[model samples]
Each structure stands twice: as structure tokens, then as C-alpha cells.
Target: MSEIRRFAAEARGGTPENDNRRVKDSVKRLQATVVEFNYLRSDGGRVWESSPLLSTCRIDERSGSLQYNFPSGLRERLVEQALYSMISLRVQWEFDSKYGLVLYETLKRYADRDAAQPWWSVKTSELRDLLGCRDKLTDWKDFRRRALDPALEEIDRLAEFCVLVIETRQGRGRGGGQVVAVTFQIERKPKEVAAATIRELEKPKVQRRGERKAKAEDIASTVDARKALHFLTGADAGTRLKWVKRAEAMGIELPKTASVVENLARWVPQIAAALVAEERIR
Candidate 1:
């Protein structure tokens, strides 16, 4: 129960009673859920399966512990899987809606393609099914406005990939010339930008007012320092620091009054250029 509580981002910062209630509610939902699995075999065969998500679920109120088990067949298949997608829990928890979360996961499966322009396409109805809103949003405009558009917007902001709606419609459209299919192009972020995004997401979701302000200030200062370092040196701070240590070993010294960047600027120009070029090549 404690581990589950810790793993659930939403359970954090709530009272013990509230957390316990939330956990119980989640368990009930899991036990009651019937999931369908559609697997495509290597030889072009398809496997369709439906089963209860959980075979059993038990809770001990006094002990504050919970126990659950996946259906045996589901467990076996999961354990024997040869390939799987890795989803980041922090990113998943940051999604404000289930539509966004589902869309993000669906897109992530195609993120590793080696194609020059990676993309995923599906019939509008199929996408609606994937998002579990097949019958709910009957109108195309309502579906796109209320579900698809918002989901795509959230994914573009929070996900590692910048998704763009590259194509829609195949032939003459039906249903008042509605969009029949949708396609999205996925592009991965640069390393530095992705790293910064990860750092931002890693911060606690709930923070005191003062703490949040302080963190914002600290992050701003860090960004400023990085920009300053980049301006002063051809390479980033990390690359320059590596060579700074090498410079110190070679008997190059900095005055007490000078900062690391100032001394680096004053160092042998040829050596600095060489170091920067080497770092770039690496």
C-alpha cells in the first residue's frame, strides 16, 4: 500500500484518508476492467484476446496493505513479450487528461523509427476507438475540437516529440466532407532541450509558494550562466571544465580574482580552439 501510494503521483500530498480512498477506488476499477489485446504476429497472423485485467484483488484495512494479481494468461503473455515500449512515468503523470495520455503513448511506440520523416496514420474511426471515444463524439468537428485537438496540443507541449498533423483525408471525404483519416509526423527534440525538459518535469509537482518561486529563480540563473559560458567559450560549460582541469595540470594558473570563464578566455587561444574542436568531434 505504501509503495503504491508513493508510485501514484496523484496520491501524494493528500491526507491519509483521501489517499486510502483513492487507492481503493483504483483497485476497484482495475478489478472491474476487461481489457482487449490485439497482437500482430511476425507471420502476419493476428491474435485478439479479451480478459479481466485483474484476476483477484484484496485489501486489508487494518494492515493498510493491498494485494492484486493479473489474469494468468495476461501475465504469461506479458512475461514472454520480446518487445515493449518504455513510457516515462513522470511524463505520463503530467498529462492533464486521459485523451492526452493515450495519444502520447500511442505516438511514443513509433518515436524510434529510423525513417527521415517518421509518421503514424490511422483512420479517424480507428483513432477514436484507440482513444475510447468511438461512440461518444459522433460529429467530426466536435471530436476534433473537444478531444483530438486538445490531446495533440497537450502531447506537443509535454512529450519528447514535437507532433504535427501532417496529413488528413484520403479520397473524397464523406459525412459532409469530413476528415476520414489523420496522420502525424513525429520529430525528436535536441539533446539539450530534452535534457532541460526532463529537469523541469523532475521537480515536485506540488510545492510551497516560496519554494516554487525560488526554484524558478534558480532555473533562470542557471540558464543565464549557461548562456554566458557559451558566449565566453566556444563550447558549453561542461566541455570547457574538462579542459580547464587539463590546463591546470599543465601548469596554467588562474588569479584569485578571476572567474573560471575569465581565466578560460585568457588561456592559450590555440589550446582552447583545439580543445573545443576535439570536444565537438567527440
Candidate 2:
């Protein structure tokens, strides 16, 4: 009950401190909450168990303080995972307008890159509620244009990571197809904190998993090379060679000036020109 109350508070945009505090007060008020479990026991017997999900809860009405305890390590882990789908860079509130902010927070929850995939799939209804979308609630195309696309643009431009969103439809014929889900991929850029490093998310509407992974690898290599290339272009010729030698000694496969100049991706707009001007082109 307390956990549900905390979610309700969070959905209504309460501060984290308040969210935690409310759980305690709310839990104490609930008559009882039940927890059910089914698992193998240590003695080689399968057992089913049921207990109060909130076994212990206390509240100090005057101080407005509260206390609650979790049931088990696994239960705690489940709660943590449910609460934090993703760890994100602290985003500036105003950088994203209301729609943009909603979208960013929603996607940030699914920003788990270490997973088998780098994307999230959210049902259309759930996505709408999550974004607090009350106006034009039935219009899919308009929602995508007014809310989704602009939000994507803002998050990509303002945040450290960029994302792309696409939608799928359900049903058929007669009443027209309803949108089923919205899927998108999040890609992290270079570590340098600059707007220039933000890359556009331009994969096609229907990208295969393998292709998505290939693009990810390609983007990663270019980002790495861009870092090295940026340093080399800004340094004196002597320093550039010294850096290259040190990098080689460290067993790093760097972009030779020629390779960087000739084959660099378009995202690194400055590097190739700098190399060409310096007569470093192969």
C-alpha cells in the first residue's frame, strides 16, 4: 500500500524526500497489505507463503515522520529496479518544454544500455498517461507530431544522450488502426560536454536488431576516433606525433592522420578540414 502511494506521489510530481516520507504515513494507515510468495525451500520442498507486504510500519503524527521495512533482499531489488529503469545525466529542467520533459523522463527510465538491446517499447495508452497527455487523447498522428517528435528533438539536442521514437499500430480496416506501441533507441555520445557532439538519430523506421547493433558499433568507433582527432588537430605538430607515439605504446589502435582525414564520418565536421589544411591528408 505504501509503495503504491509512493508511486502515486511520484506520478503527481512530488519531490523524492516527500515520496519516501509519505510511504511511511500511508503504510501505517492501511489496515493490512498482503504479500504472496511461491518458491523452493532449503529443505527441498516447494512452498507457498503469504504475509503482510508491509509487515512493520509506524508514523509519528506530530513530527510527520514514518517508518517502513522491506520484506526480503529480492523484494528490495525488485522495487529498486521498478523505480530506476535507468541512471541518467542530471538534465536541465527548462531545456525541455513540458512535453519534452515528460518524454525524456519516460525514456530515461528504460535507458539500460547493458541489456541485450538499447531500446524501449511502450504501449500507446501507457505512454500517453505517463506523459500526462489529456488533450487530443485520441489523435495518434497529431500526438506524434506535436508531442513525440518535438520531445525527441529537444532531448537529443539538450541531453547528453540522443534518442529516436517510432510507433506501431494495432487492429485493421473499418475503424482504422490504433497505435500499439512506441519504440525508440537511446545512444550515448562523446564524454565532452558540448552541443556540437550531439548526433542525429536517423535510423529508418523499421531497423533490424542486427543492423541497430552494427550502427551502434560504427557510431562508437567514430566517437572514439573523434576524441583522438580533436586532440591531434588542436595540438602542435610535435605534440601530435608525441601523443600518437604514446597512444601506440599503450597499444591503442588510433586513426592515422590519413585515415582520419580520408574516412572520417560527417559528424566530425572539423577534423578532416583541419587535417587537410595542415597537409596531413594522405
Candidate 3:
């Protein structure tokens, strides 16, 4: 592709002749046309083939612009040029990930103490590197283990699945046109993550002691399994049964012939156990 550069300046000289001469000389040296091609036509029987060399020459007594068209394939050339640019970008990204950790940590510290930077300005190479390292460690540990661990196996399986996709894509015609489109996923497959990204899409669960506070303090001790059962019985039986029938009619998959009192009694121990460690249940 041909390189194009433009030269224009404020009319330092006094006369229009000087201006015209300078502009004419500049245009002549560039091998460019001063007149619009669309306006000019062949005289008599002559056929003037358009060279695709177009130019716009603005000659104001003060200052103006000189524009020109070089060739037809400029757009394709531009797109090809972008491929090299993106390659350079990917290289820079990898380099940034390896050596920019200190810079990232410093910026994060500043953000913690000061105003937050705009999202566009916040670099993510270091955080990505940290997460990648943690995942690699997790994989290494899994690989060395004797048993078939589900979490480790899931990671390995995902990796192999990706490799398979890549291989299949490469087998397609000509260039590997694997323009894989990715959407932001919540990373729910593993059901767990290391300390870093774990906070991103999930939060640490908080445990509460089994106690009723404030207004319910007086009734807390009395709200037990036996009392709960008696309360259910004393409540309008017809009303409770009607509510259950309504739930079934609404296509809600509820346990049949099971009262709320019976269901709560059966599940209370399990629910309490899950809320805290078994040793902490007391």
C-alpha cells in the first residue's frame, strides 16, 4: 500500500500569487490533480480512463485542506494492517501479565485508599495472572492425587473439552476460522473457587445462632416441636387442608398427604446441622 501524507500551513507570505505557486508546486510534486476528476471530461472523441486517483484541492485566500484518493484496495489493506496491530496487542497483553503485577497491586492500594479509577483505566492482567496461577496449582495437586477427585476431574475434563473444540475448529477449511465468541459466565460449574474470584460471583455464608431476639424472646422457648404440632392441630384444620389443596391445584410439586408440622419436624435437625458445624450446634 502507498503512504499518503499532507502538508498545509497558514499563509506566511503576503501575495495570492505566492500562495498559488506554493500550492501548485506542492500538488505537482505529489503528482496529484488540482481539479475535481468528476467535473473533467475528455474533449472530442478521446476516452479518458479514470485512474481511481481522486483529490480535493481547496484554495482559499487564507488557509485550506488538500485531500486525495490513492487506490481502490485501501480498505482491504487497512483490515490486513489491523491483523498485525491485534497481534502486537496480544503480545503486549502477555508481557503486561508477566511483569505488571507490582503496578497492578500499587493501583489497587491507591484505589482502596483514594477515589476509584474508571473501569476502562483499571488494568486486569495481574488479577488474571493470579487467578490463572491458583487454577494451575489446583490442577497440579489434582493430577498428583491417586483417587478420581470430582473437582479436579471437572477441571481436567473442561480443559480436554476445550482442546477438542480447538482441534475440531482447526480441521475446518483453509484457515482455522475459530472466532470463538464468549459470553461472561458466572463460573458455577465448579461450585467453588479459590479466595480471589470466589468473591466475584459468590459470597461467604454467614451462620446465625439458633435464638429468637427482641419481640420473639418470650415465645422462643415455647416454639418447639410438640408446641408446634399442637398449634397446627388447634388452628382451623379445614383452612389448613384447603391451603394444601390450593397449592396442589396450582401445579406446585408439594409432598402429598404431608402436613406442615410433620414436614418441619422431619427437616429441622438436618437444617440446623447444615447451618453450622455439628460441634457448634449446641
Q: TM-score for each prediction?
A: 0.59, 0.38, 0.16
TM-score of 2: 0.38
Residue 42 lDDT in model 1? 88
For residues 136-237, write the lDDT of model 3, one tens digit per residue: 433333422422132223222222111011111223545564322211111222344333233421321111112213425445433443444444445566
How many pairs in model 3 have backbone atoms within 3 A of each other, for residues 3 or more apart or on separate chains, i.e. clashes? 0
- Stretches of candidate 3 exceeding 4 Å from the true structure: 1-18, 32-63, 83-282
lDDT by residue (65-89, candidate 1, tens digit) is 7888998988987787343468888
Stretches of candidate 1 off by over 4 Å are 1-12, 17-25, 39-47, 58-66, 80-83, 114-116, 170-177, 199-282
Residue 111 displacement in candidate 1 (angstroms): 0.7
lDDT of each: 0.72, 0.60, 0.33
Tens digit of lDDT per residue, candidate 2, span 61-90?
556556666667436535755545553444
Of 1 and 3, the candidate ahead on lDDT is 1
TM-score of 3: 0.16
